[model samples]
Target: MRTIYKKELARIFKDKKMVFSVFLLPVLIMVGIMALVGNLTSRQMEDIENHESIVYMMNEPESFTAFLDASDLHMDVKSVETEAERDDVMSMLKEGDADLFIEFPENFDSLIQGYRQGDEVPQIKTYYNPSEDYSSSAYELISNQSLEAYRQVLLSQRVTDMNELQVFTVNSDNKDMVVQDDQKASGKALGMMLPYFITILLFAGAMGIGTDMIAGEKERGTMASLLVTPVKRKSIVLGKVFALMTISGISSVIYIVVMGATFPKILGGDSGLDLEITPEQIVMIGVLLVAIAFLYSAIVILLSVFARDLKEASTYITPAYMVVLVIGMMTMFTTREAGMKDYLIPFYNTALALKGILTSEVTMAQYGVTLAMTLVLGGILTAVIAKAFESEKVMNL
Candidate 1:
């Protein structure tokens, strides 16, 4: 077994194409994806962090400006002399130069005071960029904050009008949820891309290395030569399958390392969730590398053994990868509590495990179970491949 393994390693290292397929290509794909994610996250963070609500105050509120001065929000409020000025600010906000545009109509303070006294109706016209999604979103957030402030002021005014000696306060009993905190906007972003990354690495490692192991051997007449050896057919299949698993495992490690190195810079801007990686994270990632590599390699080796050539092998593996890809993508579109079915599903298990590791909630039992299942599946696949290798039809081909 040692001799066979050594020889297989030598052949893989000697073949530049195989080396590229097993190692370099997967790393490139991973780095490319990480880079793209970093760019997108940076842009998104910038949009969130530097988003300054552009308040084009057409009518001045005596207290509104003072209230804004006491707050920590980033807002670019300018007194607009005409509709043209307001339009310019609106255009800038739409172009992502500003977070949002706010317009206060004339008699804003008087109308609000009158409404508080129940002597007249309150009408405040605020112009917001409805077309810009972020601008509109910011408008809603600012509006909520503004409304809360208005409610507080109105309540105080009502208390004074009623001649109440004691001041009343309103407090919410809502608990600060941990899971809700974990699934923040940035966490959702991580969840959205993390699964796809795992699936891509798994698919690439399996397909790239597995295609060359079986189909490539047939194409090179090596299968026929190996069949003549005194070694047991099962040993040959095990050696090749083990070799594929090693290659895939190394590729996955490198890919994860690249992702870890790039994550901080990618999610640095305004993504409230920290992308800081720790030693524990590194360990969890290593476990994932081994588990997914074995699982995918076993599946691909089974598919590859049935193909006569690389093209046919790809035909089978491509569709299999597409299925995994779709399942992996479900983590993005669906909520965490979406379905219990995802827990039992193979690809989904890997995806969820990766997600857990990233979010710092991976359990020892889940890791052990995933690893055990992968090994069991790989062992079963080895048995099947062994039988095929000893068959008259497979040897004849």
Candidate 2:
């Protein structure tokens, strides 16, 4: 078994092109692509922040200008008084020269003191251009912050003493009110994403190597020679599977490490991509990764062995790969808490386990169930592979 393993490793290491494609290429591509994405996103955000929004307020009160002066909001605020002026502003907005067009009610002051005004956008292009970032930002700022603030200000006039109305408070200034665990908070943010990536990447990495290792070798007529060798067929199978797992595992590790280092950049600064994994959690993750890799390798190699050539193997693998990818993506949007039964599913369970591990939420029973299900499935597949190896009819074809 050791000799067969060494032989398999030697075959891969001897070929520089294979080594590069299997390992170094993915590293360079992931880094370059993620860095470029990060740079463009940051630059886009900076441009939006620095932009001087051209705002046209139709029927704006004089006091609104005074309110803007007292606040931190800055924009090229303009008034649209007549129909001709409003039409000109609308043209400018469509042409992307103007950022906002806010229409205040004719009875603005009367409606300010708790009146039930119309709260609908008139099914026209009056609020802001959804296509333009500047327009959207300006609209959000004015509607969410400035308008809300001014409404509160108007309400303040009704109260003789603001403190007297405040029998109780909401979100008080005391630090205890905002108490939170940064680690858990970070975990909550990352838990949705990391599992999907881990599951998808593990299968992807294994597929690249496993397909070529089994089906490609068969195409080259190397599989027949290996079968005819003095070494036991089971040893040959173990040797090949282990080699595939090792190479794919290394690829997964590289992916995770590079992704971790570049994650903050990918989301553009203080995006809270940090993970607070304990040593024990790290061990659990490592164990889960191993089991997942093993299951993926078993699935791929089994399909590879069943096929006649690389093309056939790929034909079999692609649908399986798509199923895994879809499941991984499903995990990201999974809002409800997963039960032990959810963790007992094959590919999905591993993803959930990974998510649970990161969020520090998986129960012991769920974790153990995931591990057992994965390992048992892998063992069953390995046994099937051995049976296929023993069959001359299957091997010859």
Candidate 3:
């Protein structure tokens, strides 16, 4: 078994194309795509922040106008009083001449004061073209400034202490009681992403090398030569399965490293992701990852053994890849961690377990069950592959 494993590893390493496909491609693709997205996001944010917006106000309140005049926002403000003038401004906004339009109620300040005293609250209408970036930016800027300005006004009238009315207040006494406060948000973000990426990488890495291992050899007439040797058929199957698992595991690890390094930069350092994964958590994640890779490799090996050639193997495996991807996506939409019974499902369990690991939500029992089921399935698949290897017709096919 050791000799067959070493031979399989040597054969795989000797093929430069296989090594690149299984390892380098996933890393390069992930890094390149993330860098591009990060650059685009930064540029868009800069554009939104720096660009001057033109705003049209209908029946503008004197206090609001004074508030805008006091702020540092770069805006070209136009005030219209008559209905005809308001229509003209609306036309200008529609024609892209103006970025945003704000229509205040007839007696804006008086209405707000009245509403505070138990009268009907008047609504402020904002208009912007959703199809235009400048319009959207203008709306965002104006709405934020207006909300803050109004909040301050209300606070001044009602509250004695400004600190008591602040939106976010820190309770320093219980701060340390929050579990992994610094990493909680970042972990959830990573949980939503990494599971899908790792799942896909496992399947993709297996697809390329696993197909070529058995189906390619069958097509090239080299598999028969191996079968006729003194080696046991089960050892050959075990050796090939081990080789596939190694390559797939290597590719997945590369992907995890690249994503972990790039994701913070991708989010522009604003995402407070403190990737402080504990050594124990790392071991748990590594164990779960290896188990899933073993299961995926076995599935691919079975498909490749049944296939006549690489092309047929790929045709069969593509749908399996899609199924894995769909299952991984389930983690993103799921609001909570897996229950006990969920650990029994194959790809879904892997995804749920990964999510649990990332968000620090997994229990010891859930992890143990997931790992056990995956290994059991992998063992069953390996036995089936070994049985098929013993059949002359199946081996030839």
Largest TM-score belongs to which candidate? 2
What residue pairs are clashing in model 2?
A: none
- Cα RMSD for predicted model 2: 4.2
Cα-based lDDT for every prediction? 0.70, 0.80, 0.84
Looking at model 3, residue 127 earns an lDDT score of: 86
| Residue pairs with backbone overlap in model 1 | none
Q: What digit string (tens of lDDT, one per residue) describes model 1 on residues 8-111? A: 67887899997786677776766777678778866886886676666566676777777777776687777877888777877776676665555665777777
Over 261-325, each residue of candidate 3 has an lDDT whose tens digit, in order, gives 87887777677788778888788888887888899999999999999999999999899889889
What is candidate 1's TM-score against the reference? 0.67
Question: By TM-score, is 2 or 3 better?
Answer: 2
Best by lDDT: 3
Question: Lowest summed lDDT over 10 consecutive residues: which window, candidate 1?
Answer: 176-185
- TM-score per candidate, in order? 0.67, 0.84, 0.82
lDDT leaderboard ranking: 3, 2, 1
Q: Candidate 3: global Cα-lDDT?
A: 0.84
C-alpha displacement of 309 in model 1, angstroms? 1.9
